[model samples]
Target: MGSGLPRSIRFDERVSERLTSYVARHPGWSGSSAANRFVDEALRMEDHPGVIFRDGPADRRAVLVGGPDVREVIRSVKSARASEPDLDAGMVVSLVSTNAGVPARLIDTAIRYWAAYPDEIDVWIDEVESFEEQSLLAWERRQDLLAR
Candidate 1:
């Protein structure tokens, strides 16, 4: 008997082993579940993507806020960063205003919210097979009493 599903893809042994390891690491998961989760995440990432720059000039905020002097915000952010390496929305807004020539205040507000509320993404499908086993055992006991 077959599920009658067409098999267009194949998984290599190495990939299968890695997926099994991932399932073992995660609580309440199986190897097949891990494989499905990985594919789903990969497809989602491909659908929406951003560019990764290498040593490019910063200023991502100008697009968000309209400003006459974008460079000023960039300068402010750069100056602030000199004292602090760890950056927040304020620094990014300043840089964007400088590069994109947007309003500093508008970008600043947007950045604050974006920084404060980040998205958490997790994927898994779980089933309680143990409960099914218990139910089957109870049903067999009831049938045994009825047979008498």
Candidate 2:
């Protein structure tokens, strides 16, 4: 569509209805443009460890394949390594899956993404750690206030 080449395509009634609905829900999007965008985005996501991007609350985007958020899986792996420095990928998968209720395959998908995008995952991990530290400090302060 972006190549300035025009191509004609046909869709069934159900598919056409869905396209119309999607355009209606997404302001400033036309049916053809939405279809093209979704097709291109899906193709791009297919190459990246089976991960799919989805919109969540407050219009925030999340990377997900099947189970928990990719960040959540990475956080679990980091937490596990804190206790067992020799933990391997398979062990991390087992531990994260057991604790997070996500399947091993999805955990592997998250790990694959992490391998491909270590910098991005590291940023997420840092944010999580910072939040945890803040929460712990707040809890300690509350405890001190109650004991005073």
Candidate 3:
């Protein structure tokens, strides 16, 4: 039940138990309220085309839109702008969509989310860059060892 309106729905025994547990763990949330929040979140996610939150490495949540990580979308757009300083948003969207095979709408959604939560995407981008640099350094070391 929500404050604005109430509706009745049936849940399986396991679902009911889980809802109860969730409400118990989260103070100030009744089972009905928790269910309402979950439903609302689900609906909101549904409205965002091609955007989904999934567990990334180490079980951290990551946003994926249009088959690419949100960071990837941001990186692509950034790189495009860097190369062509005058490219507008629409042009960037078209370029990213063509290169990434993601629809413009999805790219727009990713960009919007990135704008709202830049720190999260920046962290992911930094992690990826660090991993790549480390990998390259390791490979170079191995090559030197083999040459020696």
**Could you tell me the lDDT of residue 48 within candidate 1?**
26
Per-residue lDDT of candidate 3, residues 1-148 (tens digit): 4376767899999999999898889788788787876776466467655667665673334356437777888888888889988988899899988998888887888887777678978888888889999999999999999994
Candidate that scores best on lDDT: 3
Residues 3-117, model 2: lDDT tens digits: 5456787999999999999899988877878878777657747766568767765232337666766777888888887877788868877988898898888888887778777
Q: In candidate 2, which residue ranges exceed 4 Å CA deviation?
A: 1-44, 56-62
Each prediction's TM-score versus the true structure = 0.31, 0.61, 0.67
lDDT of 1 by residue, 76-146 (tens): 45455675677775666566666656666655543333333223100000112355578899999999989
lDDT of 3: 0.78
Better of 1 and 2 by TM-score: 2
CA shift at 84, candidate 1, in angstroms? 30
Native-to-model Cα distance after best TM-score fit, residue 92 in candidate 1, in Å: 14
**Winning candidate number (TM-score):** 3
Report how far residue 79 has shifted in candidate 1, in Å: 27
**lDDT values, one for every candidate:** 0.46, 0.77, 0.78
Instruction: Give the residue spans of candidate 3 off by over 4 A.
Output: 1-13, 16-49
Q: Give Cα distance to truth, residue 69, candidate 1, Å.
A: 29
